[model samples]
Target chain A: MRIVEAGKLALESIWANRLRSFLTLLGVIIGIAAIVATAAVIHGLNRYVAEKLSNLGKGVFVVQRFGIITNRQEFLDAARRNKRLLPADARAIAERVPGAEIVGWEVHATADLERGEHVIRDTDIGGVTPAILEIEPYEVAEGRLLLQHEEDHAAAVAFLGHEVAQRLFPNVDPIGKELRIGGARLTVVGTAAQKGSFLGFSQDNYVKIPFSLHQKLYGTLGSVNISVKAREPARLEETIDEVRAVVRARHHLRPGAPDDFGILTAEGINDLWRNLTQTIFRVALFVVGISLVVGGIVIMNIMLVAVVERTREIGVRKAVGASQRDIVQQFLVEAVLLSCLGGAIGIAIAYAAATLLAANTPLPAEFPPWAPPVAFAVCTAIGVFFGIHPARRAAHLDPIEALRSE
Target chain B: MHAAPAPDEVIRTRGLVRSFAMGSATVHALRGVDLVIRRGEYVAIMGPSGSGKSTLMNLIGCLDTPTAGEYWLEGQPIASLGEAELARIRNREIGFVFQTFNLLPRASALRNVELPLVYAQMPPAERRRRATEALQKVGLGDRLDHRPNELSGGQRQRVSIARALVTNPALLLADEPTGNLDSKTSHEIMLLFEALHREGHTIVVVTHERDIAEHAERVVTIRDGAIASDERQPRPVRP
Candidate 1:
């Protein structure tokens, strides 16, 4: 019965002082909504990229030096930690590896050039053999791809990166245009299709020429990496072992020596992304969790003030036989109800804000399966933790003194 | 329990003293007082402010323990009990009415009346029934749904009386119950107190008005925390 009265009074107080209640809830609302919206966007972007990256094949793997991460230094460090491999290693793996299909040789260099009156300068030029196209996502926009005959001839033909074509030939076709790089004249047979951005730069902003051209122009000492495709992606490990055997024999390495290369898979990239984002989420959780602490403090202070304001009420209840424990429990329950109510409001606000953002803005958001319950649990904890001191003070008050108080 | 004490001394206190420290001075609110109240008796404690009338009412109602005294309440030594035990005695025994008509502002009459029963841990159904009957007894049968703010001064006082009578406790403690009401309403409330006394409910009322004191068969006066007078007119009291 005391609990009932306490609950009634608590609800009435919250209703009467609505502005203050709303203000107190503001902290929670902003914190939860921000986190939800931010999380949703991150999750959406990851899904979008994952779909694009993994669409072509179910389990295709890429083995490279330093892995597929963006930081060039980390790649170099990892490369140095392992031994080096020449293009002959790829040739050996292509001939001896059984489970994987169509291994490729790739080399990359950068340069400036001119042809006739057209000049394309300071470009990202990639050198690759014809087999590289089989393992990579590439399509010709005009003419045709550099064939085996062209590779053997070391033909002076170039594929214009989308950005380079747009810059050099904005209103005209790029095919049949000639450009020069490393003082060598080359004809543009195709142009890369539009690819907006990858890791913050246009993916189409690159040129792919034959590997032999890169060896001659960039010099023999230029760094390079070998890429392999599995004949059966599901049997990737078997092919990896076969490649290692072939490479060890070709390079004449001892059994115990570490190979100079790295094997990177799509799932490894996924793991790296998840680990990296999870740390960011952890930090976001801490920041938002502090808002809950502030919310708890607001609740505690209000409850204490409520206890003081209702001193006469407490006295009357006592005169009628309310026990100390009864009073304590009543107030504690009221505090719980108050904070839980605020928490519920916070969750609703988060959802509404998330929906609003998802509808009108590029910011991506989705409600987590556990977020609402976690929010409620946080509110409950805040209530209980902050309620104790005020409840105890009310319960332990002197009945006689309290009754006589105004 | 002294074999129930002849029904004339439902309450007895000896050497009761209550003092408060106000800055540098010690204010004695009840100074070594001795008193006895009979069952089914109507007693009025009257005095000016700071004359210990309220103090005696507090001690008599078992709201407070005397600094030094022996208090026998329903054959129990309330003065020697701890706060929890004292609370039990207060819950099952005393009904307090204040000058301010201290009804909870947000509670309806029925809820206010059910408060004591709640402390007694009475089942909700029985509590509801008893509270309804108590309100009907106070002539508030139609006002049970009214909160304190919704009721008039007189009606509010009646609701408080109903709250006091709900548990059928050993005694009703009324401290200036009509202090906030007009003269006619005060007279009517006093008549109700007299009727309750006649109906075998022990009552102790505190007032500063001599006319209010006349409604009780016994009148006790206190001055400076000490008993100044005690008188009872036996068999000749006007109903």
Candidate 2:
């Protein structure tokens, strides 16, 4: 028989047993939905991380006492082995590293801020050099950034993050407003432009002050983080090596010994992100694979039952001159049609779920354009893989025996 | 043993034998039966249960192959043909009507009639037209859209007959065509067969009922896997 006719016959049979067909499709539906939804979440996260990392400046790199510690053991080891990065290290890198176009350093602590009766608790406060603005550029909404002489003379002036400024000075202009940080009053010199939240955490919720004042208030025991900008983006690796050499020489490390510090670049962060997401993607793939196999087995089992139930019908078809190939084609077509229908339903459900997740939750989801076609192809492969045996069994039945069956 | 069938012959069988292995023992369904039926002949094969008449019918319909024999349909050697070739022969040269009107329960009468043509790979429009013509010939032209469950036993049988005739085969083979019908419906079906035979179609009816066998021009009776009598009646019984 022609394939079209066989398809029509399959559709008729499936339609005749609607509830059974739907039950049979459930496993495949769930399998494909899991795959599509997981892929959408991963795709969205990758884009989000890439965009966030790009905000770290084109060729900027950071040197710190502990960089990207993944586990408690690693954090403990780094804490014991690494030395606190001092302001001297930043000055040495600025003087010695020829490829470093700009070098800046910063120190941070959590502090409570108060203006008369209004108070904001546990807000991040940073002490940064004047040159840090050139390395990591922040847009100013009002007033101006600190001058180079402000750091030299330890001026009691602070730059407020957009959220901090809005909260502390709700009705008045934040510029030149005085705010108390741990009993040390500092006037706000400028307010940074609003930077939106990332992964539901507010980006504009910190205060920046001159490095000399922070040293006096928070003390010099804590380690400082050093930021370096390369003269040319293409030569960033060479500039990083130069900075590494300056820091290692200053620490007096031997040739074979590991450096007592960590250097982080944009590419390093991207690689770490990709490594994490790839692991997640692989686990999702494994789970989806199992579900699909289970789904396929269910389909095969049902098709075998259908073959037995319709033995007499098969005999009638064979008696009407349907060849073994024709019988096989008919059953195989039915199996594929059933699986693809499941895949289509799965794609629709995944799309709806992805849209809902993106709309209502902090977790982002982006439905990939190629998901539907690829899902259908996988489902077709599964159908054929599971369908062949039952179709062959139907084809090989003795016509006389089949006809004799009730 | 390799002789060709005559141009006017519809079926020829020689020393046809069929056996089955029922557990450890073998049962011989047909043993050394020879038969011939020419074109335009209305023949009846009659036998009691376990008399091998059904075996002969199955072999003649190309649904089963004999253990040892030479059988031909429309001058083609079919006993040695493979399953696919036998299926093709069944499609092009033989039409079958079962004891139970075996129409697809879900399909309309028209689609049931179009089944053979579908396997024949005929295009849709042509298949539809020819199937309609066949149903009209069976006097079911107005009942084309009715499913088998919606039709009476007689109408269902007529639909089966239309399906059988749609391919315009060399032989119309019916196995107990009226076994499930009332006497009136049986009489009508037998009359329809008579009309078809009058139009020069080769036909075979397998039944144990003497009255049903009497409708044919000739009757062959089987006893214990062999033909006991083969007689040509001067005049076949009418309605």
DockQ of each: 0.55, 0.79
Q: Which stretches of candidate 1 lie over 4 Å from their true place?
A: A1-5, A42-58, A68-87, A94-260, A356-363, B1-15, B21-27, B33-38, B117-129, B223-229, B234-239
lDDT tens digits, residue span A296-373, model 2: 999999999999999999999999999999999999999999899899999999999999998988777889898999
Regions of model 2 farther than 4 Å from truth: B237-239
The best candidate by DockQ is: 2
Task: Give a tens-digit lDDT track for model 1, residues A117-150.
Answer: 6666677878888877667767667666667877
Chain A TM-score by candidate, in order: 0.79, 0.95
For candidate 1, the docking band is medium
lDDT of 2 by residue, B13-36 (tens): 999999999999999999989899
Give lDDT: candidate 2, residue B40.
99
TM of chain B vs. native, candidate 2: 0.98
Clashes of 2: 0
Report how far off residue A260 is in candidate 1 (Å).
4.6
